[model samples]
Target: MSADKLYILDTNVLLHDPNCLYEFKEQDVAIPMTVLEELDSIKDRKQSVAQEARHVIRAIDNILSAATSPTQITKGVQILVPGTGDDSKLGKLSVFPDHELTSRQGFLPIEKNNDNRIINCALHLQSSDPHRDIILVTKDINMRLKAMGAGLQKVEDYRKDQLVSDVELLPSGHYHIEGNFWEKVSDVKSYQEGPNTYHKVSPDLLPEAYVNQYVFDDSNDFAARVESIDHEKTVLRDLGFGHLMQQSCWGISPINIYQAFAMQSVLDEDIDLCVLNGAAGSGKTLVALACALEMVIEEGRYNKIIVTRSTPPVAEDIGFLPGTEEEKMTPWLSSIHDNLEAMHENDDRPQSSVKYAIEKANIQFKSLNFIRGRSIQDAVVLIDEAQNLTPQQLKTILTRCGKGSKMICLGNLAQIDSNYLTPLTSGLTYIVERFKGFDGAANIHFEGIFRSRLAEYAEEHL
Candidate 1:
């Protein structure tokens, strides 16, 4: 609908995007007291959700603190977007207290149930403001169902940062030319430089080409990647991945074009940010690690490899585990160890070992909790399981990169573990869509499973 409707935001929405309040510009936002309690309970933790909880709480506090009087909150407090020119369209922020909402004619309360309390709060708002359109915004599927069942006319998931509606709609970073592509490119100027061939085509000819996007013409066995895009022309370079596919990195060679593209992205120093999306057995992490090792150990382009991942638990929170930070992160970083051991197999040196190579290459495992407020320079930073991170968390980690540093984000969107994230809203998808056209960024979607035949079968069937 329009931007004048009233929105009741669930806690999960705020955790998914702390800045969601501003997204519903000029729309009245009502925060349930139960949501505040939930945020307060989780704000002291080390997870990204806790950080988001704190940020949202502070933002709401700031908005309310600007109120002229305490009674203004009851009527409604104007939430201003400092630079926006429309004061007449400024949104209103209100709080719905648990005490103010009780078991009514059609609503029943479940004692000590936060979800039930939230739904009840929405029901109260819906009944009170029958003239104004009210909607409940949430990321939880069951919460939306319960809200719908509670007679709320409108309920939906937050979609502010979601560029694509589904994973199937995500950008493929490549386009296939079906016609006589060679004839289409006959008028284009071409030249060869070093290992790459360059072709300058009119921007109109390559409508779907973005910076660093691969383009293929299967009819003539021609493939080229977009090198640069400007208003006047688009320059494409022949991709070397076809030739490099057979070459071994550490001990692993790319089994498919997807893996080769992924390697090209991770090893290219010109590309500052690389996003890899693949399934469990697609060799996303393994290829990333192998490229990181090659860049750090053989090429000496970066000083070290810094790896990190979200530590989202499978079930309930088990509280804090006792150990040093590295020791505590070992459980979450088991995949890194497995990949490193595979890399060690190619080392023919008599004294070479996984421990020795890791030490020699200066590979460091970092916990995502302590990644903020520090600059990571001259390193190959690999963020694994990025699907579990919120877009806000991914932004924080990427901002930490300094000069001479490369950041590679690898994840399978379908395997996200975060309760607040979906395949379309995962941080990996965020990066892919956000940086799709940027010259310093590249994206690779792995389609092949290279681990083993059994692993491929399991990935496909199970």
Candidate 2:
């Protein structure tokens, strides 16, 4: 095993992942005094960041109490997992006080700012231990740049929560086969149900397929759907959704196979969680909303539809917003109203029939602030703009689902508005990779733009 390395953690890294303390196996971690002060400033807020701050503080306190006395925290205290019995890799955690840095020679100016103090701490540690490797781990780009400018060689981002390094390499949940696809599958055990045919094949003999994933063969115009997979068998179902895709749902029809797969996922009762990722003008929102209404209003599947999003500002400040909760959220939810209005353009009732249906169907628009500590049941929960959510926030939202409920998360990973989040570590990509082969979960990536030719051209050209 390699020798343990010293890692100086930034405040943002801890807030990004509360369990980051134990993630560095067999390595020493140091927390700057300024970081604790920063945590104290925001730990009382009512958002996810505040919650994470509290979690980190609790973890640090527990570690200190379990180890040597509290007065010895500065000298260095060994941190061990409570019950893991793995002491060979147990690392030390310590807080570098301001006096330690200020007493050192050639130390940078310890300004009142937190970022500069943190950098100075790292610099002091590097100068003290010339034989050991000390790296500064942070999520802030500007902090990294400043550290590099201060002669720190080993600076990096916390990569524990990132699932995919490249967005293009993410799984598409669909595969295409050529040259006699049906003939290749005829030798497998097969049966037919009400509307779909089922086949069981071996995972080693065929391409990898997840439950509810789409498979198309353009050579013979054949498409298959994955039903289930187990150790002994891989169950496949025929694509019986072609005719259903042609049917109108709330005045919207499938424009492409991407939309068709999305519709099949949302309308299927067997799939409880559906995740959709795509760019603007790909009909992601419109398709999900259409199927949601059909299930809630027409088929009597779900009793209500609850809509919520990250509430990240697009081009305006949220501080100046005025009115009731619903009124403040109306602008953020304008796409929902616009899609509903377009669906009801040919209605014979008044122009406000969309509003009437929303009230009659028991659809409610909610803000993401209060999603915690509530159990949602018998409803279709829609989380739009999921790319702006952190992984911790996403976990809290998904845990709110109760019995007889479905959740649909839609987002464009390329348009993340969160300052501390990236495309690789956003909630949308995290859920997509985590739930790939899990039962009752399915994900689809839409690349087709059905809004208009100009929009499609812009998507491709601009």
Candidate 3:
């Protein structure tokens, strides 16, 4: 049997998603020896990426276990898809011994760099099999440019986990109407359910409506949340603009309607997951913290508040810091403290008020490295800087939420810090699009930056 295409895997791609092997349906995948060496070096590190490295190593071993000898491993091993019994749909996996490649006229010098070695392997495969399509798949942009510049035919980024093609096309969680919302509706049914008002209208009125998505009109008269949508009709729960603007939590009120939408979701007990996406200084962290404090301290709905975020790779080895876990995490979590201080800045004694609030709310700062295989119950989990996380990393943290818990993910897509992630591939964007239609999840994208005039100007011009 002849394969149409052959894809060479990169170390970063497997680290980005361990299960990416199954993403290619029928296309054969090859792993260079250099990639395995890179994973071996990273598997012993203390960072969260080390866990992913180990996972990829185990997955590759499991697939190649069926091979009998070194020759068979180099030739190809049939990959069996879990839960599928079809033999025709299997893709072959093989290991390319790139270290044994001799110095050739066209091959890049592989003295010490693993990237050059991987590129040379792809080039050798391309030359050996002229009929098959050879593609180099990686998450590194500079590597792609380098591979293409070194005379490789096709180089592509691994886009299997990218939900949207462009970040600008992501859902904003709210629909805006130019004129009056009621004027566009020809037929509608209005009623009162207990203290809440409901409106049932044609689904055509809001073509892109989703559950829990806010809707407003320019007339400043109508504001509602999409309660339900079906082929027959769409139901909306009327939320008055005046009432939304008047809502406050922990002595903090929203400065705009966008922020009010976010506060509404973070404060709602029915919403199990609330995702806030916006520019920096859009009050994502401040609003979530205020609502979390209100729930834990004022209402006593939750037992405590847990705050965590993915640290940059350079700062992942935080074990050397002196003090307890919370103390070690304080520098990384200073933004949380800043927001707490901002909330209490008006008090006679600001530092004392902040301390009292922290104790009263029972807030705990946690590290993402220690949040695995443990169930967190009766707490509010707030994940800040969510844009720096991959989808797999985000899933690990989200699954830690146990009984009687709510999770709030705050991210700014424009401020992603991960080398392997783009705005489209950030976990923040992934969850926003994936949870838009869920009944228990709400998403809000803040457009205004209320931190200061400098931040607002920097967001626009700089």
Give the number of the best model, judged by TM-score.
Answer: 3
lDDT of each: 0.81, 0.81, 0.91
Q: Which candidate, 1 or 3, has the higher TM-score?
A: 3
Q: Every model's Cα RMSD, please? A: 2.8, 2.8, 1.3
How far does residue 59 in candidate 2 sit from its true spot (Å)? 1.9
Give a tens-digit lDDT track for model 1, residues 1-462. Answer: 234588888898988788887788778898888898899999987565677889999889977886787677765787777556344756888887755666664576766788988888778777877888889999999989888977889999999999887788788776778865667754688898886789888888887778888776654356667998888888988775356466567777888777777787777778999998888889899899888888888889999988888878711232365666666677788898888777666577623678776886798878777788889999999998998888898999999999999999988887877777888888888889999889999998888887889988998998
Residue 273, candidate 2: Cα error in Å is: 0.7
**What TM-score, computed on C-alpha atoms, does each candidate reach?**
0.92, 0.92, 0.98
Q: Candidate 3 lDDT, tens digit per residue, 231-267?
A: 9999999999888988899999989899999999888
Ranking by TM-score: 3, 1, 2
Q: Mind giving the per-residue lDDT tens digits that candidate 2 earns over 149-236?
A: 9899799999898988898878787777766676665458888788677888876545576777787766534667788887778788
Runs of candidate 3 with Cα error greater than 4 angstroms are: 83-87
How much is the lDDT of residue 33 in candidate 2?
87
